[model samples]
Target chain A: MFEIRWHSRAGQGAVTGAKGLAEVVSTTGKFVQAFAFYGSAKRGAAMTAYNRVSDKRIINHEKFMSPEYVLIIDPALIHTADFTANAKENTKYIITSHLNKEDLVKSQPKLEGKEVYVVDCMSIAMDTIGRAIPNTPMLGALMKISGMYEIDFFKESMLNVLRKFPQKIIDANMAAIQRAYDEVN
Target chain B: MAEKIDLLETEVWDGNMAASQAMRQAQIDVVAAYPITPSTPVVENYGNFLANGYIDGEFVMVESEHAAMSGCIGASAAGGRVATATSSQGFALMVETLYQASGMRLPIVLNVVNRALAAPLNVNGDHSDMYLGRDSGWIQLNAYNAQDAYDLNLIAFKVAENHKVRLPVMIHQDGFMTSHTAEGVKTLQDEEAYAFVGDFKPMNAMLDFEKPATYGVQTEEDWHFEHKARQHNDLMTKVYPVMEEVFAEFEKKTGRKFDLVTNHRLDDAEVAIVAMGTTVDTAMMVADQLREKGIKAGVMGMRVIRPFPFAKIAEVLSNVKAVCCMDRSSPGGAPGMLYNEISGALYNSAKRPVVTGYVYGLGGRDMTVEYLKGIFADGLENAKAGKPTTPLQQFIGVRGPKLNFL
Candidate 1:
């Protein structure tokens, strides 16, 4: 089983991003689960969402996870939430921040020895999607870090997931994904 | 005819969405609901379907959960298929009407997203609401995942509307754990699903004015006992066979087999964990891990909670040396309900196992894999000792202190 955890605020679309990832992975005929824990949480309050993918039916429902990948859509959550609570030794971190890996580690010493990748998902979303919804862009960075799918194929799958939106909004999202996919370091 | 919905062969859905789709496929005539947390989406989605002309049904918006069920009872008695959804406080408010729906023999399907009742005000999943409705004369069916929630809703209509067993049915899924969690659910086409549920056959419906009949008739001291006794007898004897027939036919059509009780790796096992809802699936996973370490572990889940499945439960656990009854609801002051029921079931067995009770996951507290491993470890010890090594009834996953009671 492969587990991924996302740290974001209540309204930031972590749950939507996780479900979108699950939707694409499930099309490959693997079982997937996406869920979140919100205990009467309000907007802007820090929260976490999760995704699990496996070849066999996934049945474990515990909120606790030793996540293999950690995606932080809200950089401030790095200070607020315990993003490393149940991390695996080889867990990979893909974070949305203006700071590069060096400055990020210097500011938050807890990530000193971690395998971290940086992407400006917030700015990417703002520039391409005309909004600060960093979730889709975060997924793009995740794809780059994990190599879970080809960039073009992942973007196409996401188009179907976002099919309900207007053509312009969908195209903007596609651009957001591509920009973050290429710009992540 | 209701408009058909085009769906993918597999759709990503939460438990609430799955249930709503089932309601739409069943092509229900009425859904009177007052929405609440977690469960709100089930009816909300149904209302959307109604608004989109996908359903030829009345979506009655009522004031409270009491009125929500009261509307369902009225619509059902008027000879239309009816359903609703509720949880926690909403369920508590519907308690009185629940008995009415059953006593009147109204075949209203209720999707109960199980949650904890509150003075502390929790909106998360637990079996408190499920346990509260156990004695209300409804045939309760539990779902461990989104797919089960979908399949069981369709099955509930068939079972509840059966002429031999005209009782309201409740399909329960864990509140947030199942209702809010999204997963890939294999869906049946609308035509296939509607055909399996068939058409509603309203017996003694008030709408049939030519054959004028009475409902909710007052039963005084002379007849109340007989009324109660007959209802109890039918629940004990009649519902099981009808359920068996429905389950068999469903499996034949859909290839998803359902039984009164779910047995996982129980054969040739020495110790087992008995649970319900989503916990059953987790326990089954843990049982597999335990087996690798050479402990013969297994799990038994109750699919049919109201009829209790006494004989089936006993037969399944008859061979195991020890058992743990993991009840997600608080027992208040006594042993957990499953612990008491399982003990009673095995009281006369020829090879009775040592049974222990565990109270866990109250108000949506996480029942991690580690806690299940600990429970299985105790089960192994109890099996070897031929008695409980831990306390007869203990709480798992709670903080502050180790709490146990007799």
Candidate 2:
């Protein structure tokens, strides 16, 4: 079983992204539960969504206070909140920021030596669409770190589930997801 | 006022302790709590029970209401009969978990003591907090007074975990009216309570180490929807008789009978008042005075609010000319949330009577007998013309129609 936590602001689509991932991973015949803890009940408030991926049926429904992975959708939160509170010792960190691998590690020394992958998801999202919803890009980065599933499978799931949104948005998200899956290191 | 105290059986405690004791009596193996107002007392009592060896359970002291409920989902899935208590805005924080627990098919019991959801921040009695999660797939029950609070709790656990109808149940009562009010509560000896309701053996539990089974695992669209449909049909239809049977069993054990709904005097009445919770008392009084003055009116207190005794309401109120529903909540984009659900249930009947719904109390504005007199008067006046007399959830006895009746 793998417990993963996603940290982002409320309006940044982190919850939606986590839920979409769970829905996609469900096709693998694995059990997954995705949820978020949010306060102020408003957009832009810092929020954390969680996912528990298990080959066997999962019964532990609590949020990932102690997680195997932390997927950061916004770099701003790293300076603000202690993202490592519940992280495990060999925790894999997937951070979405403009900074390269070296400076990102220097910014948070505690994360040094951990399996950390940094990606410029914001630039990717903005280049693809006009806005900064890096959830898709971060998912791509998560794919690179975890290597659990094919990028094509996840991209297909995102397109299938987000069909209700405009095609441009869908295409852009698909592009963002694809680029992060390839470029993140 | 010096409160009257009693002892001997359990412990000398008040209503909060009573709720805690009931949770314990029902054999709650997992409890998640983050102390807040009105609700804080119950959690404190829970901690007291845990410390004094009152309950054999894991109490996860969470940092926030969201964590409390999330932990409860975990513990409940672990195959333990899990429970929690909260009120007002605390309930708001619990809303997401509320839906998740239901969809995940976790049979957890929550005591939603009614308190005001605030903008001005008043910690008092009201239904607005729980009102937001009305459609959260919980078997909602409202207790009129203290005894109802205790008895209904016992019934809640039984109904919630029944294999035939595995659904969460929310037992709500006025925050102070029942949460703090001292009343004579008959707590069966642990053996008696346990015996009356068989040991809760969760189906396909996550905690059964001997025969390990998966809980909250993913399902295909076909299987997922199937489980949900089965849950709904069983709870909505099969539960009708089960509700009566459980109530009958409870009555036999305690010599106290509870109807799915209690009808006032609807035989020859033209205007009928419908409500739930402590407001029922004021409604009954006003209904009595209205009948005396030849208003041809009556009141009906709805106890079982979910799988909401709609058939009974239709059977009883179909004969009445016009029925006025005094809802304590405002449904977004509509008038009353309960009123809308009730109306939808009654819409298809051929003898569809006129249904007038008004948002009666918001933010726990007092619903005294005098205020009820005005509500009945409004309903009676509206009945003559077939329309609503006042807004559905406006604060009574307050100036400028607070929130302008939503």
Provide DockQ values for all models, in the order shown.
0.85, 0.01
User: lDDT of model 2 at residue B357?
Assistant: 67
Q: All candidates' lDDT scores?
A: 0.94, 0.74
Candidate 2: which docking quality band?
Answer: incorrect
Q: Please write out the lDDT profile of model 1 over residues B256-306, one tens digit for every residue.
A: 999999999888899999999999999999999989988899999999999
lDDT string, candidate 1, A101-161, tens digits: 9999898988989999999999999999888899999998888889999999999999889
**Angstrom error at residue B236, model 1:** 0.9
lDDT of 2 by residue, B1-406 (tens): 1111222242223356667767766667889988766767788877876787767778899888899889989888888888898988889988988888888778888888888777768677767876766778888888876567777888888887888777788888877555654333446776677677678887878767788876666889759888778767876887767778899999999898888887888877787878888777557756776777878878778888877787887776776666767777645566676567667767887756567666655565556666666666766776776655555444456567355453
Among all candidates shown, the one with the greatest DockQ: 1
- Weakest lDDT window of 10 consecutive positions for candidate 2 chain B: B1-10
**Number of backbone-clashing residue pairs for each candidate, in the order shown:** 0, 5
Candidate 1: give the clashing pairs. Answer: none
Candidate 1: misplaced stretches above 4 Å?
A: none
lDDT of 2 at B126: 69
Here, model 2's chain A TM-score works out at 0.94
- Please give the distance, in angstroms, between residue A111's alpha carbon in candidate 2 and its true position after superposition: 73
Q: Calculate each model's fnat, 2 decimals.
A: 0.75, 0.00
What's every prediction's RMSD, in angstroms?
Answer: 0.9, 22.9
